[model samples]
Target: MMNALESSSTRPYLIRALYEWCTDNALTPYIAVLVDDTVQVPREYVQNGEIVLNISFDATSGLKLGNEFVEFKARFGGVPRDIMVPMDRVLAIYARENGQGMAFPMPVPAASDEQDDAAASPDESQTAEAPAGEPAARGGMQLVPTDEADAEEPTDPPPPPPRKRPALKRIK
Candidate 1:
């Protein structure tokens, strides 16, 4: 049997499931993506190194949510643009209406990380880029818990409720 680290990534599958969930409930599904040279989208639409895409049936054409990528055609400012975002670049997929969905941890590899990897011995490279004791990585992607304590049961009390909502409120 394949070990957990040897298995494929679950990010793309989760994105597909969330997209279906949003559409089934009449909500707009939007994906927050981290822009990089590998991502293919209208550069003008990207803001602060990220871009949010609407992947609803009405918004995108030829949408293909594959294991490796999310390919589709979306319109930006009346111009139909082709979008191809790598699965790893997707940060979150949430319903625009209720803001309910999954938020994945963005894998921010250091600029010089790859160089160091290549220099390491073959066996050393097989281990996870994440710190020790965490889950091992599969290829270049690693799915780790948001908090180290998440791996075990919570012993502390829940966080206090927020004092107020976000500063920029939507009146509409």
Candidate 2:
């Protein structure tokens, strides 16, 4: 028998489900990961200690969505790069088209790790885990649902002309 904390994590399963959902709906699956020494990704591509990966069938080769890690080979700057993301480092998995998917809680660092970093940065160690149903912040990034007005717009506008009316407006 295992205690609640000892049970296997559900993050991998959710990832697989969302990946399948994205594919079935013709959406591109993307995963946001918190980069650390343990994570293997292109250092140049990481920004603000985070990297968003496209996990779609078109983007990756030999992709393995495993219980412990998300392993894949992807091309960056036209060069092939092997990527490995530990399950704990995954921040969110969603579709690029509509941003429909799930956000996961950040992993709490082990007591030993906390002790090692305490001398270097005391403030980070003091942050508590999020409540049962809320997503936690990691590497100074927190994902919270926000309205369109609150979301930041891209600096470069699309080249196409703006539509006079919304495309397929939903009436409630």
For each candidate, give its TM-score against the true structure.
Answer: 0.66, 0.68
Best by lDDT: 2
- In candidate 1, the residue pairs with backbone N, CA or C atoms under 3 Å apart (3 or more residues apart, or in different chains) clash, namely none
**Model 2 agreement with the true structure over 115-156: per-residue lDDT tens digits:** 788767776656556545544654445546899886888788
Q: Can you tell me which runs of candidate 1 are displaced by over 4 Å?
A: 110-113, 116-172
lDDT against the true structure, per candidate, is 0.82, 0.84
| C-alpha-based local distance difference test score of model 1 | 0.82
Candidate 2: residue 43 Cα off by (Å): 0.8
lDDT of 1 at 145: 56
